[model samples]
Target: MCYLYNVESQNTKGPGHSRSLEVPPVRVLLFILATFLGFVLLELWLYWQSKDKPLQLGLWDLIFWGLLIFWSVRVEVRLPLNAGMSQLFLFALALVVLTPPWVAPLAAFLAQWGGSAWYKEFFNRSQDGLATAIAALVWILAQENPLYLGRWDLSDGVGIAAAAFSFFAVNSSLVAFVIHLDSQTPLREIWRRNMGWVALSYILLSPLALLLARAYETPLLGGWGGWTVLFFLIPLYYSRFYWDEKVRLEEAFDTTLELLMNALEAKDPMTRLHSERVADIARDLARKVKDGDEAYAQAIYRAARLHDIGKIAIPEAVLLKPGTLTPEEFALIQSHTTKGAELLSPARKVAFDQLVYNVILHHHERWDGRGYPKRLAGHEIPEEARIVGLADAYEAMTAGRPYRKAKTPEEALREVQELSGHQFDPRLVEAFTELWEQNPIWRDRHAYLAAKEGSVSRSTSPQRSSASASPSPSEPGPRTSEE
Candidate 1:
């Protein structure tokens, strides 16, 4: 998998890229602006083209649009890819099969425009209008007039399927285009990541669109397909409610983990920000490793932040000791891993996976056969553990410790590079180095602090010497020169 770090796109910067709704880039705004004008032009052209058509618009089609407007405006289920899922599609098909191809998309645009304006969402009105116009235009290309075939059969159903799919495809493409412009995410990535399952949803739901078109088109059904949708509509509204509850539940889990982290932080005042920095590094590393999403990286980050929760079981005397730990005290401190895992044991009842527990328990393990608790060797430790372990070491080195003052970020990175294949995963070290180079905060912290303190700048070069007895970071290893 090609990670963004290796892609060399200056805009594909690392983790702390905030997406909190500030004013978007001018380019994104301009793109949306251009789309809105295109939609207006398309609507006018479609109107002019349909003005002289032999076919006349029907009352049932307008009724179907009203039903669509009511059901669609009531609820929208959020998705990772596009904005939301709603039931405007059922009528979109009705327009293609029973009325002019342009009607559904145009009606949907008008309904959405009115609704969004009432809700004071001027921006969404623009998005709705453009997206609908695209869907309408594509549907028109597929069907010059409504399919007037009588006595439905497999071939007839296939035409319905094809027409509906075309509209959905064009609609999704428009939405994806805007998302690409707004997020600066790669267009291909957005389609693969966000639109893959969306296509599936459209496929699965196309039959309902077909059914609605059939019910309304056949005079025997009395145009009650609009009311028939109530069955699915009720469940869809409830689904949105259920999804909201699930979101709250996920937030509650995060808050509980944060509380545990806070309790652990109470034991070591100096290391309060330690877990957060490690989480930041671990998140970036996880994203590089899997080509995973920002959300997945954040999950790793949340898990990393809780890696030290077991330390809450340790007494302050050993945990906060001003000097190096004695053998027994160190062993006791090490037991916090097992203790931390035990503390989190009950969370399994609620479906918490072993990944977080593995990270907490084995983050201290080494790449070589020499680590604590289980004494596991390379690849024996969980991948999450190896990642958090490296992040912990870097943070521990850069962060001032009870035993010694903090090393510069440069020294910490050198220590990380040297430990690869000895204490840390060599691959993860390489990944970390890639991320570290991208984010400036990791390198700038110490220098800015020194400047503010009016102290002479300490050399951040890798040649610094420390002779601590601990096997960690004191003696640089053979692979120190690799990168």
Candidate 2:
């Protein structure tokens, strides 16, 4: 199986769908038990069938391929989010192709014995072993006997391809499902975002396993295919470099965006962790509103975080004004929406998605069509913008400016409810109400900060931790801070 493991990071770009990747301990344990038990049952059944009719099994071949797979398992390449990929599947699948149904999965189970924590290692071994068992069954169904140079024809190639595809499908689904359970991300979305490209690679590279099996069968290379198998190392080593560069580039992009966010916060201290709080709320609401579209949920999350990017360009004088703003000053403040959109436009093709641009430009727009910039109202405003707008208002109301007293959580909830149809999508307001009832840490600023502090001190899952932490949101600052 092509194993994927989560690597925790602050950036939300990769596969770790949410800030907290916690799953119900019971569910995870049940899944591991089920998977491991299923593999054992299959192995026992396969062994029973083999006993009835003796089949050629190569112990030396098993040792050689198991060691190769172990080596591959040790060198995993990181992917975005908490996921990773490695060449473990290549040799493991090759072992499935060349050996009997019972042998390869056992070898795979043993090969994955001690890499990660005990629970993680057990889960990996179980899933990989189960996937190998299923793929080995597919190979047996396609071609009754193991492949040799004599049997290596076009039809056998089709069987190998089918087996390879089955392996990928089973393996990725198992991993994706676990991630889905852990992060509450949609299962289909997980596969679409993470496993789509890897599927193609599985099919394209399956031929190499066939060649390996054939090489072992051939007398031209002396003993087994061990000598030629060594050649796979060069290409595998180089492939790691490719994935490394890709991950580096992604990290660089994330870092650059963070720097921009940092600069925005420095210019407007009021919005320090304000964006992160709003983003957390927006993402939660987005999942409720657009549960089927993972991309939209993720986009709204990103857009909420940068919704105030335009505020960076606003003059500090007007931004810091304590008294009611003059018409001209208010206008200047509103133009931050357009300015932010323009500033981010250059990166649209490269980094920012259209939904992100929409939220940055239109987050302040009111549902009643009275808001600024485009003044797009109702459904005319992008749904992404509407979601962010509602979240931003809630966050800003609770995280009051230095000149204004911050509203209590109950007061903020009432205000949000009162403004429902007039300032927010009624459906979204309903969704937010439900989320509020759930009492997510972000629903209350004080609780959010407490949880953050606790998470830092106790190393717990700080689901509500924003992009950055600072003094309390309600505390006064150097200037009159406005949302």
Runs of candidate 1 exceeding 4 Å displacement? 1-29, 54-64, 77-85, 93-96, 113-120, 141-203, 219-223, 292-299, 440-483
- In the range 290-348, model 2's lDDT, one tens digit per residue, is 76566667677777888888888989997865555566777788888899999988898
- Writing each residue's lDDT as its tens digit, candidate 1 over 1-483 gives 000001112242456643232344687567656756776787787778776754455666586566666456545554443344455665556565666545655666666522221212333444454445555555555454444457533544565566556656655665667667656666765665445534665666667666666655454434555456554557656644765465457557768877777877777766655677678778878888878666566667878988888888889887876655577777887788898889889876464677888888898888886776688989999898998888888877776555555667778788888778988889998988988887645454454335435552334322223344243231233212100
Taken over the whole model, the C-alpha lDDT of each candidate is 0.62, 0.72
Residue pairs with backbone overlap in model 1: none
TM-score of 1: 0.74
**Total clashes in model 1, counting residue pairs 3 or more apart in sequence or in different chains:** 0
RMSD of 2: 8.5
Using lDDT as the measure, which candidate wins?
2
